[model samples]
Target: MPRWIDTWMPGSGPEAPGGGYPGERLGLPAQGVSAVAGFGRRLAALTVDWLLGYGIAALFLGADVGTSPFAVLGVWFLLTAVPVAVFGSSAGMTALGIRVASVGSEPVVGVPRAVLRTALIALLVPPLVRDSDGRGWHDRAARTVVVRTRP
Candidate 1:
């Protein structure tokens, strides 16, 4: 029996050959997360998005910006969503100190996934779309998770 396995697995010896808790590799934290924490972070992210969206809309309403209302909305969405997903933080996320990261072991993320995630997020309903993991469609589509920033 491997000593490390014994330490974490407890009752199961190394020769017991698995089937104890059934998740996580070793010392790493369990992949499963709390729904409440995720929801809170998402709410903060949404607040940031709201501010940006309304701010853009207001700007478009003004005579100074030549962009059409729809164009301004589009720009607002792009500006807000793209940077947030790829970098794991946007103006809102930055303010809230939360970041979006891939679910996989690697931290590298791409634009397409980010775009899809952002689009779903804009729907404003799908983020509430609960799955087995309690993640919304946006989170699932992006294959990303939101994490709080370190101080």
Candidate 2:
């Protein structure tokens, strides 16, 4: 039935403005620094971090990395958590001109939140599930957001 289909499928109602653009609900700027980072930027940052982690594991463990995924995971966790805890950005995020920030005024995310966020990100699914505001589950759980650093 048309009614049943409409009810079953969300976003199928009459066309209407859903409010403002992404991040506007969070009071983020439309552009420039403090604006929400887009998917491409986030993906690029993740790619860089993953490559760096892989390289580290390969360098330290050599061929052993091919046999143990945990090694790569451990390195990736460290690569993602440490810098985010101390500097609010990893090497990749810094290079991409983006940084993770708490919803509040905290300069750094601290160890606990950073660790939790990294762990969720490592699960892969959490990072792929985004909300209407474009925030991933990992970020939402950690109460952090990735924002642009430069205009």
Candidate 3:
């Protein structure tokens, strides 16, 4: 793939007609390590993240965060962005056996992209919309994808 094309579209591409699996266009396996993560795993990972974020929010927000809400979201942003920038996986993603990786880069997304990705996820609309490859708009916008680390 050309660097310019990758620059423009990140993980977008055409694959063989019978590829028959998500992530095929991005040169990922159909199963096991580095395969595109399934929606159920992604949702479960997010549930864990949200619970953890709420726990941390309770520490500072003193019950008002349940009303304010954005504080919880803010904590979630930090929880996702910082670890994703440094380790390629948030705590929940790690626990769930997934990691976020840039489609055009080798291992991890940088801080700016991680922040953007987390912000889009916070919107609650982008993550619900997925492309053929199972990448949500948040992943697309960040030029990143979530892939399984284990089978």
Candidate 4:
């Protein structure tokens, strides 16, 4: 009988060759800048973006973000999608030293992919469902990945 660890864990059996860390399969560096962004960094970037969205909605739309969910979401979507499309990262992502990039040969994620990714992220559940490599469903659907910009 095989050991439980061998049965459940990937790359654990003799036939399985461990590729490397989480994002290594995607050709990302194992550590330092350009590595996959971890959960804590991703969460921090999200928090920053949310706060910015709330602020924009409250100030420009003159809506109490606490009471106006749609306004905040709209602002959030704009903040996330537009910047990621053009710059590869939002203000929050930039501040947190992370960026979204295509999983393919391209270095930048185009507007369509950014929009789709943002939409799925807005649905909430998609972003919560992460693959073994830590890529959310939104990312997989868009063929994009978030990576650290600095060591």
The best candidate by TM-score is 3
Off by over 4 Å in 3: 1-19
The regions of model 1 sitting more than 4 angstroms off are: 1-37, 63-72, 132-134
Give per-model CA RMSD. 10.1, 6.1, 3.3, 6.1
TM-score of each: 0.63, 0.86, 0.86, 0.85
Query: What overall lDDT goes with each candidate model?
Result: 0.60, 0.85, 0.86, 0.84
lDDT of 4 by residue, 1-151 (tens): 7885553233343331463576866888888898999988888998999999999898976745688899899999999999999999999999999999899998689899999999998898887877656788788778888999998
| Tens digits of per-residue lDDT for model 3, 79-146 | 98899998999999999999998899566699999998889888898898887788888898888889
**Which runs of model 2 end up more than 4 angstroms from their true locations?**
1-17
Model 1, TM vs. native: 0.63
Worst ten in a row by lDDT for model 1: 20-29
- Which clashing pairs does model 3 show? none
- List model 1 lDDT by residue over 4-122, tens digit each: 43332323433223532222222223333311225676687778676686677766577644556566557657876678656766787777666776677666457777788778777
Q: Sorted by TM-score, highest first, which candidate order results? A: 3, 2, 4, 1
Output the worst ten-in-a-row residue range by lDDT, candidate 3.
7-16
TM-score: the better of candidates 2 and 3: 3
